[model samples]
Target: MEKTLVLIKPDAFEAHHVGDIIKMYEGIGLRIAAMKLLQMDERLASIHYAEHIGRPYYEPLVSFMTSGPIVAMVLMGEDAIHRVRELHGKTNPAEAADGTIRKLYATDGRKNAVHASDSPESANREIHIFFNETEIYD
Candidate 1:
């Protein structure tokens, strides 16, 4: 089965939508293999967003992510990475589809309510960054 990393960002947590979001994923048949709620430190934020390090919105984006507790999870299923992204909708809420998570909860690009790994390699890396070997189950 394919595995993917999913982050229910601080915005969603603050809005009390974590359960709703998890339910949505479960409704779609994706298994929640592992999960945790934690506040991200600056160092972890930097590592998680390493690729966007030098971008204009990088610092603010990191700050937003670290602002509150977030739900980090590993979802397993066929094409999990792609499936989760589709469920999340586009990166920008303004452009997201009507029924997508982002469209329903996100206010903008920077405040987009969730994050999902875009590829298998990223999924592996992100899943490791947040979860240990025993956290994930088949």
Candidate 2:
């Protein structure tokens, strides 16, 4: 089985939609191996989004992420990385499919309601960033 990192962003938490979001993932047969609610720190957010460091939205992205508590989780399943991203839909809600999580809950690109690691390497890296090995129990 593959593993992926999933983040239910602050907006979801603030809006009280965490249960509904988690239910959507569970409905897809994704197993939650580890999870937590955390208020992201600037340093951690910077490291997590290192590739976007030079992008114009980098600063704002980081600030937005740290603005409230977020739900971080590690999901395990077959083709988990790609599967979770598909479940989240496109980065921009306006372009996401009608049935996608973002399309249903997100208001825009910058305030997209969720994040999923794009690859196995990124999944592993992001999983470690938020969870210890033991935390991801079978």
Candidate 3:
């Protein structure tokens, strides 16, 4: 089984859509390997999004992420990385498909509901950012 990291962004958390998002994943047979609700500090957000550090959206992205508590989780299942990203849809909710999580709950590009690891390598790295050995279940 593949394991991927997912982040229920602050906007979605503030809007109370965590259940809906999690259900969508579980509904598809993805297992929640690890989960937690916590506020992200600037340092961690920086580390999580390090690749996008100099991009135009980086500043506001960090600010929004650190603004409130977020739901961080590790989802495990076949093709979990790709599946979760597909479920999350486009970065901009406006461009997301009709049945996607972003389409249903996202407010805008900045607040586009969720984040998922883009690849297997990224999945392993991202999962470690928020979860430890004891935090995840087989």
Tally clashes: model 3. Answer: 0
lDDT tens digits by residue: candidate 1, 1-138: 999999999999999999999999998999999999899999999999998899998988888988999999999999898889999999899999988999999988878889999999999999999999998997
lDDT of each: 0.93, 0.91, 0.93
Q: Residues 1-138, candidate 2: write the lDDT tens digits.
A: 998999999888888889999999999999999999999999999889999998999999998999999999999988888888898999899999988899988988978899998888888899999999989976
Ten-residue region with minimum lDDT total, candidate 1: 57-66
lDDT of 2 at 132: 92
lDDT of 1: 0.93
Q: Show where candidate 2 strays beyond 4 Å.
A: none
The lDDT-based order of candidates, best leading, equals: 3, 1, 2
lDDT of 3 by residue, 42-124 (tens): 99999999999999989999999999999999999998888998998899988999999999999898888899999999998
* Candidate achieving higher lDDT, 1 or 2: 1
